[model samples]
Target: MASQNDHFASIDIGSHTIRLLVARSNEKLEIYPLRLERRITRLARNFQEGQTLKTPGIRESLRVLEEYAGILKCHGVSDVACGATGVVRKAGNGEEFLAEVRQKTGIAAEILSETSEALLSAKGVLSVIPRTEGYILSFDLGGSSTEFLLLDTRREKPLWHTSVFIGAATITERFLSEDPPPLEAVSRAVEAIQDALAPVFQAIGSILPAPPTPFPLQVVGTAGTATTLAAMNLKMTDYCPSRINGLPLTENWLTATIEHLVRSTLALRREIPGLEAGREDIIPAGALIVREILRGLKQTHLIVSDAGLLEGLLLDLIEKKYGRPQALVSPLTWRMQKG
Candidate 1:
């Protein structure tokens, strides 16, 4: 309806990390990223259902958002879109925390509902993994919750989607406590993850149509857990987004890593090539969550998508500004074209 050519920013404040994506739009409706960054604050650290946002987490996230605000100022970006998930949505002090953010940084954050998180994340995941099968199952594994979205490529909307209470940090806190966790701890964690997923799988089965005239469902994973695992698989010393997209994470690798992570101490896990520093405590639990979800769906491998709600936030703003394009340029393709 109107011309839109301005820099925009999107922040996804999650249970475990705070992510920023700054981009500019063009006449062709393509997105060009000016910067991409993520910092682990564990906003839901030591969090449980119906809890308050922790003091330490609030402090750290505010610090990071201040830095993000500085970055936005450098880019001359005034229009910002933010979506807070998992911790923010479930916390009793969600609005208060947001108010503090607004007061300090002059940025307002919308606490995204679980379903909206799933849908936006799926769009971002779909944007990266080009030409996937008709039946796509995408999951974003975060600190306090995991969202599962089943999408059919031919359809405009998802077939089924839901968010569950279990996530990397929570599952580890509940079931895996030992550094270099014992076999018992690993076993118990696996059992609990399976139990939590059982009903979700059953509902999926009830609704799922036979896949793609013959093709099986395409599984894709997002958020910190998935991207970190993808990095580990590639033995990547530094994080890379475009390369991480559509990378296959196999069951054998998943199970082997699970075993290795369980046997290694937190300090030892940090030594591993791809594992980031702050994630050592929750990785074992995160791997198991990935394992159990795959096990339930009878899927062997999942595509790792570095892009998710973070990118989705930017795409959404572009649409709102210029209205939906005659054709959309997904974030991944835009990056490729910019190259």
Candidate 2:
């Protein structure tokens, strides 16, 4: 078994950003989150016409990884797990890129398949929420792809899952071509999303047994897009998951919020309550993608989950090494690190 003081880290190399989390696990099976960092590298932005990560994208990714490596060292991280999503999974040169990243960062990076990504995301959301006995939909919207999974809380397992190529960053680049996009541009984007989601919806429909009654489905959204929306809904001057997570956001409020965002300029988005500076440029695109997903699912409300792949990965590692938690990592540790 890994030692109590051994430091473990997980790095999520995503299309829009790279995130690293460092934690220490104790003999009592508690894990304390120590450090968190994120860098916006836009690794998928330069993908060539054939869906290959361009030379420039690889170079930028390497630079970001080198920086993250330094941070890990400072935190005394010994065991590392890293994964790439979306662009790398689809790129022809993905394997080659992964090799280069490992060489430069001294961290082996695995490219997760679509189904595995969906499962991990679902696991992360479920880890935080109260266990219920109904169907739960978990969605993670990254820069280049969005993953959807249907979890059966009754059975405590994922039932159906799929990954869609449309995501906040890519869709924005594809559809919101205009600054404060024209109404037509917005419509086109929505239409495109609807078309792309049709197959997924049908696939889900085939797998899910008809509801015995009209039960209100619980929806959990993770990743930056969801967190941004939740923060905006709360009108928080500063981001706080304690205030935002699991908060019930009604459909009317979400619609109103989206409409308000669509009318504002990027500069103005930064000034708005709950909107973070790093998210200002992409929030509009994210809003559109989220709004369309809700519309497609006919969902009126969703619970935001700040916990995601990182937390999921941590849980898996802990369980494999030491079984279920006898004691949780100190909440004080989380507060201090988050602050």
Candidate 3:
């Protein structure tokens, strides 16, 4: 078991950004955050032409990881867990890049497979809400892929957990070739998103259909896109996780904002407060992902959760070192009411 005062760190190497979360365990075995940092490196830029991470992106990501290593060393944190998502998973040289990371920074990053990613992301959701009843649908929108989780608290595990290739960065790369894409381009993007999600909805099966679920459903959106949308809605000039988390983002607002964003130029988007500066080009695609998700589910609102895969990874390590604390959320055990 780790000492009570020991500090730990978790890193998520994502397609568009690389994030680090440093935390400390208290006397009572509860983990408290020490620092959180994110940097955009567009690790997936021109990724499709060749199924490999670009040299520039690789160098930039390694540079960020090296910086994180220095910080971790300063904090005296030796136990670190890092996970790489879609961009790395799809790239032919993904493992090679990780090898470079280990060699350069001594930080070994595990690539999360699709299903494993779905479950990890869902666990991330539990860290925030901790408990729930009825149906909870959550999606983590990323640069290369988006993962969805449908949890029925009455069951032990999720009703359905799936991943769709449609993502903000990928969609932008595919359809939005023009800056402030033309109407036709936007329409194509919509159609592309719809098509990609069709099969995922089909796989959902009974209980919750693709058309729309009833009153008891609660949709949650996690990760960058969701939090960014919440930040924009709040008119925040900076990224503040507290203000964003648990905040409700309604469908009306999402669709309206997406409309405004798609029509605005990249320069105009960068000027918008709360919308991260590097994200201007991809925000429209991210917003569209959120909008279409709600529209398909007939959900008017979704609660944004800033805590995600990174937190989940840390919590897992914490549990392994010290047995699962009762304070952490239990498995789904919601009882349903029948007419």
Model 3 per-residue lDDT tens digits across residues 38-131: 9998899878834899999999999999999999998888588899998898899999999999999999899998877777777777776646
Off by over 4 Å in 2: 46-49, 211-215, 323-339
lDDT per residue as tens, model 2, 223-325: 8888878888777886666676687766777778777777778877778888766677677778777777777777788888987776766666655555554
Of candidates 2 and 1, the better by TM-score: 1
User: Which candidate leads in TM-score?
Assistant: 1
Of candidate 1, the 10-residue stretch with the lowest lDDT total is 325-334
lDDT score for residue 242 of model 3: 65
- lDDT (0 to 1) per candidate: 0.86, 0.76, 0.81
Q: State which candidate has the highest lDDT.
A: 1
Deviating ranges (above 4 Å) for candidate 1: 1-5, 210-213, 325-333, 336-339
Per-structure clash totals for the candidates: 0, 0, 1
Better of 1 and 3 by lDDT: 1
lDDT of 1 by residue, 140-205 (tens): 999989999987777777888999999999988887877777898788888989989998999888
